[model samples]
Target: MVQAYILIQTDMGRAGDVSAACAEIDGVVSAEDVTGGYDVIVKVEANTVDELGKLVLAKIQKVQGIVRTQTCTVVHV
Candidate 1:
């Protein structure tokens, strides 16, 4: 499986709702509101890298109040 961490930015006061919505997405393992440059951090997995991209674009990005996202694919050394 392909795994990634998605850092999300949302409009002010929307982090909690955004995180909760992301947590419900099929590929999302965990979604939490966080402090710092990003408002939410999500761990997700999919069958392939392309699938992971699709999930991020089609599902996670469409969550209400999201302003932006940065996806970091996991690497195993």
Candidate 2:
């Protein structure tokens, strides 16, 4: 399985809205509003890298209030 953490940046004052929307997406395990350069952070998992990509690009990015995102895939040593 592939796992990733997506760091999301949203428009000012929209972090809660973004987190709420992202939480309902299929691949998103959890989304939380936090204080940092990014507004929301989401954890996601899928059976393949391609599927993970689709989850990030097609699903997560489509949520309203999101401005930008950086995806970090987990690597096992």
Candidate 3:
């Protein structure tokens, strides 16, 4: 399985709503509002790297308040 951490930025006052909505997506393991350069951080898993991309592009990016996102895929050495 492929796993990733998605860092999200949202419109003002929408971080909580965005985090809650992301947590409801199928591939998302967890989503939380945070303070820093990004507003929300989410953990997700998928069967493949392509699937992970789709989850971020097709699903997570479509959430109402999302302004931008950065996806960090996990690597095992």
Candidate 4:
């Protein structure tokens, strides 16, 4: 399985809404509003890296109030 952390930057005052919306998407494991560089931190998992990319690009990025995103794939050594 492929897991990733999506750091989302939302439009001002929309962190909670964005987080909630993200949490509803199919591949999303969790979504929470946070402080610092990003407004929302979303944890998602997919069967493959390609699927993970699609989840972020097609679903998460399409959510309203999202301004930008940074995706970090999980790696265990």
Candidate 2 steric clashes? 0
Please report, in order, the local distance difference test score of every candidate based on alpha carbons. Answer: 0.95, 0.93, 0.96, 0.95
The runs of at least 3 residues in candidate 3 whose Cα sits more than 4 Å from the true structure, single-residue gaps closed, are none
> What are the RMSDs of all candidates, in order?
1.0, 1.1, 1.0, 1.0
How do the residues 1-77 of candidate 4 rate in per-residue lDDT, one tens digit apiece? 98999999999999999999999999999999999999999999999999999999999999999999999999961
Stretches of model 2 off by over 4 angstroms after superposition: none
| Candidate 3, residue 75: lDDT | 99
Q: After superposition, how far is residue 60 of candidate 2 from its true place, in Å?
A: 0.4
Off by over 4 Å in 4: none
Each prediction's TM-score against the native?
Answer: 0.97, 0.96, 0.97, 0.97
Error of 1 at 66 (Å): 0.4
Cα lDDT of model 2 by residue, 1-77, tens digit = 89999999999999999999999999889999999788999999999999999999899999989999999999971
Off by over 4 Å in 1: none
What's the CA error at residue 68 for candidate 2, in Å?
0.4
Q: Candidate 2's error at 17, in angstroms?
A: 0.5
Pitting candidate 2 against candidate 4, the one with the higher TM-score is: 4
